[model samples]
Target: MVSGGINEILRAVEFILSKLLSELQSEDENDVEPKTKVRLIVPNGSCGGIICKGCATIRSFIEKSQAGIKISPQDNNYYGLNDRLVTLTGTLDDNKCFNT
Candidate 1:
């Protein structure tokens, strides 16, 4: 037989546990985000072809891109240049926040 105070405490604990479990479950369902690949579409002018002539300009554009891109600090390699395709990898959102 439980005393009144102990019974009240147990009930409160059970209620808190139930609430926590529900919250966890809900978060699990809604917290998943899809990560995909994003590529740069170099326009015509000096930024076309496999070996782009405007490599510096393209690099500068990506460095200053409004899209939130997660780039490696050690990654200073030029992409879309010398017939090479460089890809940036990370999870991005509509706001362009890239995860490093």
Candidate 2:
């Protein structure tokens, strides 16, 4: 009975280690890419309400968005609205804006 219990514990430890190794491998693979670029056309105006305020300028909005930050512009404010009319072409990485 003691030996059997020890075997079971060892199996559990091995299973946990295998899972951790798999996750580590996946994380390494994901890290290989390092970053990706995506362009979005934001509306020229305040997002109002929540999630997107004070993001009046394209640069500011992009900076805030990349930082995983949120701002609240006034209701019906025209901050990010202009970008909608004119398309913005740029590159972004996992960190922030990247030069194309």
Off by over 4 Å in 1: 1-4, 30-100
Model 2 lDDT tens row, 1-100: 1135866866664465456445655667756433322233334353332233453454464565453333323334654444332222232223232221
Clashes of each: 1, 12
Clashing pairs in 1: 68-96
Candidate 2's C-alpha runs over 4 A off are: 1-4, 30-100
TM-score of 2: 0.26
In candidate 2 the C-alpha lDDT for residue 89 amounts to 29
